[model samples]
Target: MFHTAICDLLGIRYPIIQGAMQDAGGPRLVAAVSEAGGLGVLPTFGGTEAALRADIEKTSKLTRRPFAVNITPIGRAFTESRAAICIEMGVKIVTTGRGDPGLSIVEKMKAAGIVVIPVVPSVAHAIRVEQEGADAIVASGSEAGGHVGRVSTMPLVPQVVDAVKVPVVAAGGIGDGRGFLAALALGACGIQLGTRFIAAQESEASDWVKQRIIAARETDTIVSSLMTGKPVRALSSRILSAYEAERARCSDEQERAAARGRFLSELRDAARDDRTYAAGEISGMIRGIAPVRDLIEAIINDAAALAEKLHALAGRS
Candidate 1:
C-alpha cells in the first residue's frame, strides 16, 4: 500500500528516505533503515574521505539493500572530493544538502550511472538541481533539524513539485505515518525523516540527546547558526539560549566568533549537561526509542491504515 514512484526510483520497498543526520547517522543506522526497505543515507557533512569509504563498506556488509551518501557542500573541494569517493566506492545513490553540490559534481555522478538527489529549500533551488540532472529532490524546511531554509515543509513541497520535473520528497516537521500520508497528499513521491530517526535505538546520538528529544515540546527548538555557521534547527538549551543572547550583544565580528567558539566548545564537552543538538519540530511527537526496522514498519503500516480510513471517508462524501 505504501509503494510509490520513489520506491521504484530508489529501488526500495517503501517510499521513505532516512535523512543523513551528521550526529545520529552511521553505518548501523544506515544499514538498519536499508534493511527495513527505506533508503538510508550516511552523512558526510564534516566527515573525511577515509571515513566515508569505510562507512560505505561497513554498511554494505551489514545489509545487501540500497543506501546513499549525503554530501553537504560546505566547500567546493569537500563536495567534489566526496562525490569522487562515492563514485570510486561504487555507491549507487547520493544525496546532497546545505547548498548546491555544483553542476560538475552532479554531472560526474550521472556520468558514472549514480543517482543524484538534492535536498532543497525553495522552488528555485529545486528547479536548478533538476536542470543539473538531479534524479529526485528533497524539499527540507526550516522546521528540520539541521541546516534549513526559511520556508516550512507544507508550502515548500508542493511549490517544488509544481516547479520541477523530478520526483519530490518532503522533509521537516514529519515524524509519523500521518506526516507520511500528508507528504503524499502534498504532491511528494515519498518522505524523508531525520529527527524521528535520531530517537531510534540504532542511532548514534548520545543518551542525553535522545532523552531531550523524548521530553521536548513543539516550541522547545530554535534555529541557530552557532553550530556550523549555518542555520540549523535544534532543541534549545541553556548554552544555545545563552549564545543567542551573546550573539545579540556582540559588538564586532571577533566577539561573535569567540562566542561561537564557546558555544561549540560547550557542545563538544557536553558541558553543563546543557548542550543542545539538532532536532526538528517533530521532537514533540517522539516519546521513546525503538528499533529502526520497527520504526520504518510502523510508518508504512500506519500510513496504509490511515489511507484506507481516508478512502472510506472520501467514498461517503
Candidate 2:
C-alpha cells in the first residue's frame, strides 16, 4: 500500500482526502470516506453551533475511524467556536481555508493533539501556515470548484512543495488515477479532491446535480461573484447565463441596478429552474457514480499499476 506524511498524520490508510464542500460534506459522505480508509472532512460553513455539533455527532456514530472538520476563517464570525467544538468532540484533524485562523486557533488545535491542515492558494500562504504550525498544507488551485486561488495545480503543487517543510496536498483538476500519479510526481504527499467526490453515490447532492456534473464539459464551469459576494466556480447553468446576458444588455446604471436585483432573485431559487451545480473543471472526466469505497480503491489500484509499469520501463532504459 502507498503511504505518506498525510496518511501517518491523519492516521488513515490512504493519503486521499475528500475536499470539504459546503452542504455536500454531510454525515453520510464524511463517514463513508473515513470508513473507506481516507479522511472525510465535515464543512461547518452556513450552519449554527447546535447544527454543527449534531452533524459531528452523527458522523462519529457512523464511523470510529479518524475524520476531519473544516472551517472557513476569513469572514465567519464563529470560527473559534467551531474549532473549540471540533476539539471538544475529539476530531482528529481541523482544516482551515480562505484565510489563516490566526495563531490562537492553530495553537489550540495543535495543543489538543489535532493535526492542522490549512488550504492555501499560493506558495506564500503555504509557507506562512507552515510557520504557524500547520501540520500540512492543501495547495488548492484555480481549477478547483467553489472559491479558488489564482494558480493552477500543475504549477502550484511543486512551488508549494519547494517552499514549505510541511506535507503538501494538491487540489484542483484531479479526478482519477492519472491525476493522483501526477500529484505525486509534482512532489505532493497527498491529494484533496472536491469535484471527483461530488459524483460519488454517498454524496448528499441531488440526482439532478449529479447528472448535471456528469453532463458537463471542461468549459462548462465559470468563476463569478454573482452567486456569492466572493468569486466561486460553478456550473454554467441557465440562471448564470441569464444573469450574464442581462448584464451585457444593460447600458446605464438604472438598467444595471435592475439586472442585479433580477440576478439575485434567480440565484436564490436557482434549484427550481436553473440548478447551479457548483463543480470543478474535472467534472468532464467523471463517467459514473459509485460507492465511495469502490471509487477510492479503484483510484489507488490503478495508480499502483501505472507506477509499477513506469518503474519497469525505467529499469529497461
Candidate 3:
C-alpha cells in the first residue's frame, strides 16, 4: 500500500533507504536493513577491492533482498575496480557521493543493468545526473550527516522533484513516520535515514557514539567545516569547539592555515573522549536502539496510521 517508484526500483517493501555511513554501515547493518524491507547501502570508504567484494558476498549470504554499494568519487584509482566488483557481484544499485559519477562510470553501471543513484546537493546537479542517465537521485540537504548542502529538506525535496524526471529520495532531518509523510507530501518517493539508523542495534557504530546520539538535543548539532574537509552537521564536541576558537582567532591566511593543521591533527587523535558524532537534526526524536526489523516495521506502521488520520481530516474539511 505504501509503494512508491523508489520501492519498485529498489525492490523494497517500504520506501525507507538506509543512508551509507563510513565505518558504520557494515555487512550486518546492510543485511539487516535489506532484510527488514528497506534498501541497505554498503559503504566502501577506506576499503580495498577485496574487502568490498568479501563484504558484498557476506551480505548476500545474510539476505536475499537487493542492496546497494556506495562509492565516494574522490579517488578514481579504485572506483573502477569497486564498480567492476559490484557488477560482477550482481549488485542492483550503485550510489555515488561527494562528486558526479562521470558518463563513463554511469554507462558502465547501466550497461550491466544496474541503477545509478547519485547524492546531489542542488537542482543543477540533479538535472545533470538525470541527463547523464542516472536512474534516481538522492537530494541530500544541509541537515544530513557527513557532508551537507546549504538548503533544508523541506525546500530541497520539492525543488529537486520539479527539476528531475527520476525518483527523488529525501535525506536529512527525517526520523519518524511524520517525517516520512512530510517527505511524500513534498513529492519525494522515499526517505533516506542516517542518524536514526546509526543508533540501531545492527549498526557498527561504537556504543559511545550511539549513547551520544541518544543524549543529543535538537540544538546540539552544528553544521561546520571543522569535522571533515566539507560542511557537515555533527554534535557539538571539544574538537568542534577548539576548531571554532582557532578559526575565530585567526586574522590572516597563514594563521588560518596553522589553525587548520592543528585542528586536523587533534581530530585525528580524537578518541571516544573528544570524538565528534555526526548525526541529523532529528537526533532528539530517537530514544533508544532497536533491531532493524523492529525499527522499520514501527516506522511503516506509524506512517500508515498517520496517513489515515490525515485522510480523515481532509474528509471532514
Candidate 4:
C-alpha cells in the first residue's frame, strides 16, 4: 500500500532507503537492509577504495537484491575515483552526498547505466542536481546526523519535490510510521533513514554508541563543526559542551583558538577509541537494536496501519 515511484525505480519492495553511514553501515548492514526489500546504501566516506570494493563484493554475496553506494564528494579526485570504482564493480544505484559531485561524475555513472541520486539540502541544490543529470534526489535536512545543511526536513522535502521533476526522498528526523507517512504527505517518493539504522543489529557501530543513542533525548544532539570541520549533528559531549561554553566566555582570539585545538585533540582521542559517533535527533526515539529486516518490515507495517487510521479520521471529518 505504501509503494511509490522509488520502489519501481530501484526495483525494491518498499520505498525506504537506509541513509549512507560511513563506519556504521558496512556490508552486513547494507546487505541486511537490501534483503529486507529496502534500498541499502554503502558509504564511501572515511574509508579506502579497497574497502569499498570489498564491501560491495560482500554485499553482493549476501543479497541478490539491488543496493546503492554513496560517494561523499570531498574533492574532484575523490569523487571521480569513487565513481570509477562503482562503475568497475557494476553497482546499479549510486547516491552522492556531502557536496555536489559535478556534472562529469554524474555523467560517468549515467553512462554506465547507474541510477544517480544526490542528497540535496535545498530547492536550488535539488534543481542543480536535476540539471546535472541526477535520476533522483534525497532531500536531507539539518536534523540528520553527519554533515547537514540549514533547512529542516519538514519544509525541505516539499520544496525539493516542487523544484525537481525527478523523485525526491525525504531524510532527517524520520524514525517511524508517522515519519514515513509524513514524508509521503510532503510529496516525497521515499524516506532515507540514518540514525535509526545505527541501532540495527547489523550496524558496525560500537555498543557504547548504540547505548548512547538509546539514552539520548532529542535535545542531546548538537550541530558542531568541531567534529568534521563541517556542521555535523552528533550527540553532545563534555568536550563539545566545553567548546561551546568556551565559545561564549573567551574574549581573546588566541584563547578561543587554543580552546578549539584542545577540544579537537580530545575529540580525536575519543574517536580513536570508538567513544564517539555521529547520530541524528531521531536517536531519541529509538529504543533497542533489532535486525535490519525486522526494523524495515515494522516501519512499513506501522505506516500502512497509520495510513488507515488517518483515512478513517478524514472520512469522519
Candidate 5:
C-alpha cells in the first residue's frame, strides 16, 4: 500500500531507499532492506569490481528481492567494469554519485535494462543528471550523512522535482515517517535515508561508531570540508578538530590541498583499523540499533497512521 513510482519502477513494495552509506552498507544490510520491501543498495566506495560482485552474490543468496549497487566514481577507473558486473549479476538498479554519470555509462546501463538513479545536491546537478538520462534523481541535502552539499532538503527537493521530469527521491534529515510524508508533500516520489540505516543492527559499522551516534546531541554535528575537498557532515570529535585546525592554518590553495590529502590519509587508515566515524546532525536522533525488518515495519506503521490523520483533515476541508 505504500507503493510509489520508485517502487513500481524498481519492483519493490516500499518507496524507501537505504542511502548507500560507505562501509556500512554491506551484503547483509542490503539484503535485509530488500527483504523488508525497501530497496537496499550496496555501497562500493571502498571496494573493487570483484568485491562488488561478491557482495551482490551474497545478497542474492540471502534474498530474491530487487536491490541495487551504488557506484561512487572517486579516484577510480572502474566505472565500466563495475557497471558490467552489476548487469551480469542481474542488478535491476544502479545509483551513482561523486562524479557525473557520463552519457556512455548511462547508455550501457540502460541497454542492460538497469534503472539508473543519480544523487544530486542542487537543481543544476539534477538537471544535468536528467540530461544524462538518469531514470530518477535523489536530491540529497546538506543535513544528510556523509558527503553532502549546501542545499537543505525542504527547498532542494521541490526545486529538483520541478526541474526534472524523472521521479525525485528526497534525501537528508529524513529518519522517520513524518519526514517521508513531508517529502511526499514536497512532490517527491520516494524518500532515501542514511542516518537511520546507519543505526540498523545489520549495518557493518563498528559498535563504537554506533554508540557515538546514539550518544550525540543535535548540536554536536558539524559540516566541514577539512576531511576531503567536499563538505561533509559528521559528529564533532578530536580527530575532526585537528583536521579543522590544520585547515585553518593554510592560507594558500596549495597548502589547503596538501592538508586535505593528509587528513584523507588519516581517515583511510582509521577505516582500515575499524575506527569510528560519524554522520549528520540526525545522529542525535538515533537512539539504538534495530534489525532492518523492525525498522521498516515501524516506519510503515507510523506513515499509515499519519496518512489517516491527513485524510481526516481533508474531509473537514
Candidate 6:
C-alpha cells in the first residue's frame, strides 16, 4: 500500500527493499521478499557466474514476482562478469556497490532495459551516481551493516534526496514500520533494511547468527575497519577484539598491511562457517525471526495504523 517512486520504478508492490547481505541474502531470502511484495536482492559476492545463474533460476522458480541482484565492484573483472550474468538472467534490477558505476556500466544495463540502483554513502556519492544515469540511489548511512559512511540516516537521507533528482531509498538502522514512515517523511521514496531481514526465516544466515542479533542491544554493534580495511558495522566479538589488538601493535605500513591481511583471512573463514559478521544497531529492536510473508504483513499493518492515527490527529488540530 505504501507505493512510491521506487515501487513504481522496480515494479514492486511496496517501497521496501531487502538489503543484500553477503552470504545471507541468497535465493530463498530474495524470493521470499519479492513474493511478500517487497523487493528482495540476492548478493552475488560468494559465487561464480555459473553459480549466480543457477541461484537466479532457483529464485525465479520460488517466486513469480520481481527480484534483483547486488554486485559490489570490488574487483574489476569479477564485477564485470557478474553484471553480464545479471543481464543474461533477465534481471530487472541490478544494485551496484563499493565503486562508482561508471557511465559504461550504466549504459550497458540501461540498454538491456535493467534498472540500475547504486548504493551511495553520502550526498556527493548520490550526486555522482545520479549524474552517471542511475535509475535510483540507495543512500546508506553509517548505521548500516557492512561498509558504511560517516553520516546516519536522519541527516543523510534528506541530504541525498535534495542532492539527486532520482528516487532515493534510505538504508541503515531502519527495521520496522516506524522507520519506514520516518524515511518517507524525510523525502525518501523507499526504505532498504539489512539487519531486520537477517532475522527473517528465509535468510540464509545460521540459527546461531540469528540468536546473536536477537540478543544484541543498540550499543552492542560497533563500527570498525580492522576487518576489511574499510569501515563496517558489525557485532563486537572476540575476533574483532583480536583484530583491533593486532592493528594497535602495528605502527609501520608493512606491519599494518600484514595484520589486515591476516584479519581478512579469518573473517573469510568465519563467513564460510556461517558466522555472524555485518549487523546494524537495529538488532536491539529485533525480537525473533518470522516468515517473510508475516514480517512484511506486520510492517504494512503497523504502518497503516500509525498513518490513520496521524490523520485523526490532523483533523483534531
How far is each candidate from the true structure, as Cα RMSD in Å?
A: 1.6, 2.4, 1.5, 2.1, 2.2, 2.1
Span of ten consecutive residues with least summed lDDT in model 6: 267-276
Best by lDDT: 1
lDDT of 4: 0.90
TM value for model 2: 0.93
Query: Which residue pairs show backbone clashes in model 1?
Result: none
Error of 2 at 273 (Å): 4.2
* Model 6 CA RMSD to the hidden true structure, in angstroms: 2.1
Model 3 spans > 4 angstroms off: 248-255
Candidate 4, residue 17: lDDT: 98
lDDT of 1 by residue, 44-132 (tens): 98788888988999999999999999999988889989999999999999999988988888899999999999999999999889999
What lDDT tens digits, residue by residue, belong to model 2 across residues 1-317?
A: 77998898889999899999886779999999999999999998778889889989999999999989998885535888998898898888899878889988889889999899999999989988999999899999999998888899999999999998888999999988889999999999989999889989999988878888898899999876566656678888777777777777889878877777878886786665475656999998888889999989998999999999999999999
Model 5 error, position 97 (Å): 1.4
Q: Which portions of model 4 show Cα errors greater than 4 Å?
A: 247-260, 271-275
- Give lDDT for model 2: 0.88
Clash count per candidate: 0, 0, 0, 0, 0, 0
What is the alpha-carbon lDDT for the whole of candidate 5?
0.85
Candidate 6 residues 1-317, lDDT tens each? 78788888998998899988887889999999999999999887667888788889999999999899998887768877888888888999999877775788788888999999999888988888888889999999888888898999999999999888999999999988888888988999989989999989989988888988999999888777875577889988767777778878888989988888887778778753333389998999999999988988888888889989989999999
Q: Runs in model 1 with CA error above 4 Å?
A: 250-255, 265-272
**lDDT, model 2, position 230:** 61
- Model 1's lDDT to the true fold? 0.91
In order of appearance, the predictions have TM-scores of 0.95, 0.93, 0.95, 0.94, 0.93, 0.94
Candidate 3: tens digits of C-alpha lDDT, residues 225-311: 775567778888878877877788889878877888888888888786687767888988889999989988888899999999999
